[model samples]
Target: MNAVWFVRSRQINRSISWWLAITGYKTSDRSFSNRIYFVYLVIFFAIWGLTVLALVTSTVAEGLQAFDPARPVWLAAQITVVVFLAWWLWSLFEASRRSPIKFTEEDAALICATPAPRPAVAFAWLVSAWFTTGLLFWALAITLGFARAEIAVGGNPTWADAPFYLSAAGQLLLPVILLHLGMLAVVWAFGCLRLNGYHSQGSLNRYPLALGFIFTAGLVFGGFEGIFFQSMAWPASAPVLSGSGLANYLPGNLAGLAWAGLGMGALYLASRRLNLSRAAQETSLSGRLQAASILGDQKLAASIHLKQRLKSGSRPFPLPGRPGALALSWKQILQSVRAFGAGALYNWSIVFALSLAVLLAPNWGVRGVAALFWIAQLHARLTQSLRLDLDQWPLFQALPIRSSYKLLAEIAPPGVLAVLVGWAGIAIASLLAPGINLWGAALLLPLVIFDLACGAAWDVFRQARAELLLAGMAPSPSFLSLVLSGLILILFLLPFIFFNAGLEAVLVALLWGGGACYLLFSLASRSMRKLGK
Candidate 1:
């Protein structure tokens, strides 16, 4: 096969693998035939059930709602939904085409050497496109039909009475869909062009820096324009072509259609012009300097190397100081707090501040509380990996350390940070909000602390199931963790939600209840020592 044919085949094969894996039909020697068939049956039922559910829910929800002729929000919402649907369809098609498949260098060479018929390859590509595009169109038609039926039934009117509403909805959705498709085409063109440029380079060193600059500039420009745009009102003079029979709307509609056609053409031309064979050449001067510097200052080079190792989460050379085991645990806690990225100690501080904001924000208290809960959950999961550094653990074990000491070490950084930040937030809010007493602020600290402690404990519990928890690091699977965290959050918020009964009474109840639960769990831990290990 030619290069294009080979690439398409590899893409299909990879998609098949992903489909099988998702349906639990492992394509491995250990997979049983019965398990494969069972998985297929389950997937078949799942897809059927989801389709049925969507159809039923959409029908019911639509039937109860009347189409308001005067409300622009409804039209805006419909356009937004249609645009999202189009983007979702495009993303699914692209994801299927880029699935990973392992291949050797020799296999690649052999495939490149083959000379397949271009017409046949093009025919195959067309067939794949037809199926994917057809599915999207079918879905769109079903959705539109369901929406129209719902509006007609709910408003107790015939199609003839409100043909204008249907026309208006269609007019709104068409432009949105076209805009989405145009954006996708632009992105596709950019990716193709970037890949071609990278292939021309023999080395990738400068590419990273170049890409970073491009990303930073894009963010700055995009954010600036977004804020600027949102502040301005839509131009009143812009022609609003609606409800004028489909034929009357056709002129403006055709203009939009023409723009979309131009965008698609540009994308196709960009793809064809992609320079796939170009290779980057390396700079020789930088290579020579690095060799001389290493020889001339061996000591400095070693120190620099040690710093790099530490940055990569490796232990420092010559070992850590001979602190007591508890002291060593404190050091580890401090390290986790100072560490950057997702699990950094600084993020937990933010979470603490947000929690206080939630408690104090007048109208926005509920939303702030929900956001705080999410941030705390995220911090816990992000920091859970710190325990995986076995080298750091040995230093603790070598000294006189108990499991409780280890657990305390794990919990201290997040707990203390959460408390301090939470207190500051409450103090700031109390200063601004009148009628808020000292007792209420004092009560808020314990509640926040308890919630944070529980979150930390759950994270540790998840680490005990390392394999499952690690697998769940991906955002999709992490939903289960989110759900569990949400439950704990509800428990944390219940006392505050009913604080009108008296702050002292609520605090006493929470402290007693939390203390009892903690003692019970601690006692239970003695029996479940294997998990702690």
Candidate 2:
């Protein structure tokens, strides 16, 4: 075998062994346990996959039968395209920040110092990263194909038709794989150029921004909207909307060809210009990030991510010179600015978009689910400021301010931001969805603040317990914490269910929200005092 394949195989084996060892399946003495564990995981995923497939087929059938202007298949196609484009741009943005392909310090010492071919080594790294990171996309492609196959067969078939299903999955998998491969290659090519000093990080970063701008402009003004949207939808919808033929399939076929051609071009560029020495220097960060993920150290992972963003191009936000409780709030703002800079705007934009979705949903049931999803996402963002404080517990405990003030200060900034962003979304939704009760929408602004306060309080309390036991490292939130938090938030929203849209509902919601916030705040403050001790 060539040296490239040999190195790649060894790397894969080492990763699997590391994971197995961490899970207490030591190669020296636990061979049987390892095999048993592997079999258990396989069986679990197989059963889970079958259940998901059954749900998908049934749900798609129901959605198709529904009398709605936005057909389920078309909506799915739109969402799939949007997700793919977002991921593609994100990959490029990340590549600009750090090398897409990474080599460990050992690889630097051995491979970089040796006469191993640079192109071959780059290809191996690309393949390894793609296989490991692209598993989700592969599953999504298969699921999409399965959905399409059900549509093609005109009914959901029994298990006896497994061969037909497999053939359909195979048919769609090739194009999706090719399209994914092209995206990866393009990102890898950019990383190679950046490592070779052929492109400045700042300039490379602008590539995605520029492409996004051009794409947006085209949609608004360039009159290619229908054609662009039709690319993913045409093949899926044509059978139902326009009758199936070779013409219906032409767009998808052309797209596959284009992606394949693009992959070849990008690979050629990377092969000709990749620099091994610079790649070796840059890859250590990737190794650190990967290790943190494998060990499930979220704080370490966040720190590494912050460090990478700082390196990419961070703008300095002015810090307050005052020292005390106020300093904590300033530090939160500073950390957010330094970590995300202008990119934070997109986060708020998502809040507004999700709000619009929740308000526009057809029924209270759909609206409730969307609102819950929105709250879950908001809770994650709300905890960022609290985490900043928790990460520096030693210094935080040293502050002269009382524990209650410190806790309140930590949660205040993000809670305020959430209120403002969510209120903006509500205002827009009121304008767009005329049926929305303006009074109810306005009442949500305060509820948003209290909701964040309560959620942040719980997060602080849970994190304090974790930090106390784990020493300095704050582990990711446990499943129990998430479940409890969701339940608490649901209770806070329960007033909307008990009282219809009016002053009574608004008053009850305010009382419930305030009561929950106060209770959680008291608990969290008590926990913070323990940390101080």
Candidate 3:
């Protein structure tokens, strides 16, 4: 146990040192680069702090306006229930598939070779995993506590006044944090059992899956009952917002915390029975996956994940018998299918959800959120096929096809899919939401197409440059290159900025999108051709 702690401490120190070195810091000497890095970080944090503070202030103000003082308990309970349900389902799914306790390849190798106690190693890894995974949640909870301070004592308070409300905020925050940790403890317990090979045998293998199915069905039925009863307005129907005093809620919260603490205690006792060798074997790929993620090489991480998934007896899609560009398209489409089952349909569903949200939004805030969600999803999905193609650039380049043809073939499947989904989402949203503007809905077709083309073009350019860096031919693209690309995109989108979503805007977008797609495709082809040379 002591040895495990020592190893973990040394690992943490090594990681910190590696990060510092990467950021141009040296323990031996102070240099100009260190100062530059220090200034950059200071400026970055200054900007980030200001932006976060403003956003939190606005969010808190909005929330407090709609907050019901009589139902604080109800709100907290609802949040707790939602978080538990999500974590429960996720834990079951992940444990059924793989071990939740992860180690780096190095750590796994060391633990497997040594006489270290399995329970202590698992506990250490569990804590490390929980902290790493829960950091974002912890941050959000802390921010909420900070924001709640404004309304803590029933007045708008400045930063100096916030301290007065710290007691109230802490009351809210402590339980929330404990609840999250408790949920993670439960998950780790289940994961340890899975890793120890307890759940691998024939009958027990399907036990988790059966439970997951039952849970899903029960959830669906309960939701239906709630909605049905609420809509019928039965006298006994539970109110959506109901609460009691904080004093009444406190006992139940304490009871829940006690239960979780007991579970954690049991987990440590049971960990001694775990199979360290099996655990290490199961998590071998996970270490590589985590290493790739830590190094900011998401593409590498994704590729590793895909390969892992394929190792479960699933083969790649067979190649098309046709030659030239058709073969490239088939390869891209197959890769997409194998990497993400029905991913195109999933993307479509997201776009539809966003579109519906936009139309049904009662305020600019909701609409803005919907738009942001769409943009984030669009950026990721639009480049899916192109990234896959770029990964195997040499194979595609060697094909007996023109560069332009190859580029067109690679982009066509995903680009067309994106435009189709976007258009369908908008059209269906218009039908479902009669209040939306007909002209705006109609004009969105071209705009969506234009957005897809622009996203693909930019992604291709960015990824192609990264490929060059990976191949040792060039350094990564500079800030200037990024600025120039943005300028070019703005120029293309300039005409639509001033016009309303009308016939004129539609015509402009259609022409611009078509021309831009052609030009960008040609540029990509030319750039890619220079790869081998």
Candidate 4:
């Protein structure tokens, strides 16, 4: 008993240590510690608070004395809980099977040399697995059971009530069961493939089998439950069927649940068997590899060869230019812009998705949706530009061209892409909402161009600030700088958005902003030239 206690304590300590490591906690005396702790605490509290709020909202909705049958919030909550349970179960099973036992050479040596029992260590690991994985869900189920009981006693049922409740529960449980079956099949197939030595060879013969199992399981169980409930073959007069009329189909639901459980059990057993086989295979391979290395085998040596590659891949075709200062500056700007575009795909995809949705959606929805997409695109462009300015200052200095030109070049591609994409989105909106004049196109095109120019100038100023910070010449931008910049951009774009109000106002604003930006950029270019030298 004492030995068991020690093992349990050790396992608990190890679990805590592992969690800390994964979460990036380290013992350090840094000023940033407070900031890190504050962020962590905020996130933790926010998650817990949200979860509690959801639970309360769900409970209140369920406990209402007079309920609207059409309102589906309670049903949604029940479905959500069941889905959560299914996901929880799937994650737990996956974690338990995949978490490798940390058996070291030292451990093996100790096992051979010491009188200490290995069973204690094994027992502790088994217990840790339970707590780390499924135990949380088990506790959640208990809490949910209590919540359900309270709601059951608190509410008086209408004819639709019992059927609705049962349907809600069934809807939730069916998805969970189906999800579990699908995940179980996937894990089972992967285990089988690993056991069969197909994984190492990269063969995908088992993929179809795995996918088939998943689809078949999910569809069959989900479909059966849907049909059974729809048919309403069960007696409505039955006591269990009194409220929701769902208890009539309880037997079929149970059968489906049982089948899902059986699938999960089969997956678990398959996984265990496969895991044992893999351990044996790995042990055998380790022995063979050790033997080969000891024997000074040429093939083993060849297999272990390492090579160093240059950090940068082959360069693109160069323009016909002297290796002078201007040429070098152009190269740096090009490189930075190229890098920016590489990471812009995700943002661009979002823009495209929103634009397409707006085009396909109703005319009434088009304006609001297009505006949101426009805002999103603008944010992405600005953020990308800002990040580039922050990172590439040294490269900018090393370039042969003037710093201002380099900054302009960096902003040009995205600015152009943004305008084009924005126009395309507007065109889409126009198609959906007939009688909307495309005259805004002329105003918007120039506005986007002017905005881009202004944004580039602002980014250059921010970069200049960053450069100063690096050289200890100036302080970094305060929180106020960020707020002011955001406000300025919004203020600048406000007139452009309201171009339909008056073209003269739009044109005046564009000219004022654009002229100011160009002038600043020209001055910045001269400053950059001097700094670069």
Candidate 5:
């Protein structure tokens, strides 16, 4: 028994070490050039700047909520927490469906074959991977949570209060952790059921699967929201963690925390009843997300989804709305649609949610800066199609088509798609915050979309320049190139911010975005063609 425990611990430890090494730091032993070191220095400073920026944002959020101190702060927190769970549930559904867990594929057959209980070993692996990967994220969260908590207390926390803030954050995490654990265990159990052909299986069985997903997502949403209801009693019980105090008002208070732990434990124990045939299947959203982050460009990440078209032999369908550039635009739009999934138009919904948050948020200037940060992210997603064309630049160049035509076609699809989705987001956001001028919101959406598309296309140019600078001169797609590309994006987006109502802002954005689009795509096109020469 002791030996089994030792082996399990060892496996968990090794996995943790390997994941941390890969994700947290550079892994290659190869010598770096001076330019590489310069990139590292820039990243180091950028991380520090971001940390300070987050703390400042949190503090400002606290001040803004002070306007209506009674309900708004807690409401914002509830929304923040609920939105996250919604996204988590969505990702969980997609992840399990796309890549069903197969234990043998992960080389975990030895653990299953051992005397140690298969379920026990599996749970250990799950908890270890979850903890190791999530630790950094949680650490970051602690800072923001602390800032928010200080607001709850109607006080500003100082450096000396760090320990207290961290303790509060830890206490806050307990029930939430249990809630997440239960969610995960239930999902895993469902996976096991699928392994046995219980639900969401077989052809034409998708309706049942879809229903189950919606139902499950709703349950999680309701559960998390319920857990945070205690926040209703805040300020009254805002301090004490011992009993019937502020701790109880937090999302995962002690009683709820205990129940969640027990529920999750029961779920894991229940998994022991399953038949583990030499192996079981597993794939995770964490892996794909981490890969996308490491790749540092959405195009590289988006490529993974492009190869997933169901009818490989069939050609793309035309977009009747875009007759002039339909042939050029249709494939990109279809690919974005397919890759992003049905019922949702690209990631505009997420941007909308963020925009809503920005609108509700109090600090205009800081929030503008934060919006730029969010725009930087949206720009990454927008650029995926642009990068797709850039990747096959040699092929595009080899054709007899003029460079101007190639550039126009490449940028049009992504921009058109962005406008449609961005408008969807704007419409939804308008519904959420009725204070918004519908006319102004409608007018601003296209400029916002255009800005996002142009920024992304610009990244393709930045990357092309980097590769050209380092090509034959150094390695393929060097780290410095990604760093340089990101720096350029940061510089470009610094001036663009949200306007709840304005034609001036919109016009300015259109001019800047259009000019940047033309200039960068043309430069990138010319640079990419040079690669073939």
Candidate 6:
């Protein structure tokens, strides 16, 4: 067997398996208890996924069997699926350009000096892409296929046909796999084009602006319009990917399967034309990012990644005020944009575009929960700014500014933007289905933001305290950061668990929001006292 065969058949599969095993829980080096917990968690999730697949599979199969499919809902589902698939593919393409096919330092040391290294390296790329892209499609198919599942179920209270979704999901799995192979082929071709200087990599980063704008506008506008307008043509015909309407073609036929196979094979051959040294350097970039993540320096990893995407424009924003930490906030906000340009914009657009998903959800409760979850994740990203600032704690203390002003400045812009972004999701949801629940979303989100801002400040403060408190002790598990964030989230959400949306609920939320703000303020001030702020 060739060296590539050995790596692919034995070495790489073991590495991939070991990666999956550890990544779902913790690193391989983590304690036995962590690994055990991770295993239980995986098993539980696996069972839950299978249960869901089972429950819906039969319904899906039945839906597919009908020669004449259901109309508007199905079309909407199809559109959402197509749009999201496009979005995911676009994301993968941008990411690949930023970090094209390459070998790691370890892989290069061990593998690159060998005979015919390019084929092995290319095969490894194809292999990793197979797992990642295949997994992505599996997730999207289940999710998008179930987007309108309730409507499909149609109040049928019977278990007789409830067990077929798994079988159907399994059947669709091949087409899904093929679909991602097609995507990888496209992205890989683009990477090759960039590598050969046929196209600038930065062009891949910039050209997404128009697409992002359309996606954002569609999610915000079409999202509401879809609910109001219902269908362009009610009882619209079912889309066929092969006989296309909105690109829902699945490789259910031999011809389609053959085409998909050929596309992937052709891309692999194309990638084989890549310059090994250049590809090796690109792969090293990926390795550095992965290592940074593994070492718990995600922010640094993100920064390194942005450097590769490499946006232009070093010009500063006009002074927001007389310019104290406002200057810092403005700079950070701009740097996040200018450093990664299209990559950053594309991500933010995706965040807003999720209003489409929110609109598609069956109920306001689902919308509220999803919005809050999105908001919190974005909030956590924003919170990293505080952590970044605290990295130079002595600089902050040495500044001429008062402690309270400094603290407020740190929280203001990003915190407000986080709140605004969260509400955009709600606004779309509300437009689709106007209801009292909007009150809950509108009220609840700001309170959560307030709580998060406080928590982030407190995280910085606690770190400072920890330095003074337990300077000699090693830090706790990585999960503890998540635990801290979750605790803060639960604190804010606690008031929400009992109260239904009403005049009383709104009144209570207002009072709670007010009291929470006051409390957070007091805490922030007290915490600031540590640095004599």
**Top model number, TM-score:** 3
lDDT winner, 5 or 6: 6
Name the runs in model 2 displaced over 4 angstroms: 1-7, 14-101, 113-275, 286-302, 312-320, 341-343, 357-361, 463-472, 475-505, 508-512
Residue-level lDDT of model 4, residues 1-533, one tens digit each, is 65545645664676565555555654342569755875796699666853564355356546532353543333333333344434534543443343222333433443324444433443344444444443343333323333343355444444555454434444434433443343334444343334432334234434444534553465357632355422332221121122122344455345445545554555444444343334343334343444456566534432322111123365764655445545643554565444444335777767756755644555745745564554545544544543344445565455565555565665566667766776776677677777756554545554544454444444445445545535433222234334444444455557756664477656666666666566645754564455422
lDDT of 6 by residue, 390-412 (tens): 65556655777666776777677
- 356-377 in candidate 3: lDDT tens per residue? 6756778977876776566556
lDDT per residue as tens, model 5, 1-533: 55445665776666545654543433343456644764775688667854674466466556647654765445445444544345445535653454223343234455445566646654655665456434543543444456555665557556676666656566545544554454455555544444442344434235335645654555466542454333532221232222212334544354445544664565466456544542343333234544565657454344444444443665645555544345456666676556666423436566656655544456777656656554655565566555555555544446565655655676566567566655665677677777866554455555555544544554455445435433321113333434444444443344445542356555655566557556656665565455432
For each candidate, the alpha-carbon lDDT, in order, equals 0.45, 0.66, 0.59, 0.46, 0.51, 0.57
CA RMSD, predictions in order: 12.9, 8.8, 8.8, 12.8, 11.6, 11.0
lDDT of 1 by residue, 1-533 (tens): 65666677776676566666766666563658757786777888867854564455355444425344543233433343334434534443442232111123333344323454422333334334434444454344334434544454553545464454345445545644454444444434443444343443224234434534553454356532244322321111011122112224556456446545665675566555443222011212222333435456533343344344355465453434556545655465455444444424455655755666565656756765656564555455334433433223434335455555455555556556566676776677677775666455455455445444544454445454434334332111134445554565555556666665476556755675576447534642342243423
Better of 4 and 5 by lDDT: 5
TM-score of each: 0.45, 0.58, 0.61, 0.47, 0.45, 0.51
| Superposition error at 466 for model 2 (Å) | 6.3
Task: Output candidate 3 Cα RMSD.
Answer: 8.8
For candidate 6, give the lDDT of residue 151.
39
- Per-model clash counts, in order, read 8, 0, 0, 8, 7, 8
Model 2 residue pairs with clashes: none
Point out where model 5 deviates above 4 Å.
Answer: 1-121, 132-167, 197-244, 247-257, 273-293, 309-533
Give the alpha carbon lDDT tens digit for every residue of 334-391 in model 2: 6665677554677677767787787688897887777766766676677666666666
Choose the strongest candidate by lDDT.
Answer: 2
What candidate 4 gets wrong by more than 4 Å, as runs, is 1-151, 154-208, 211-218, 221-345, 349-379, 382-396, 428-445, 448-500, 523-533
lDDT of 1: 0.45
lDDT of 2: 0.66
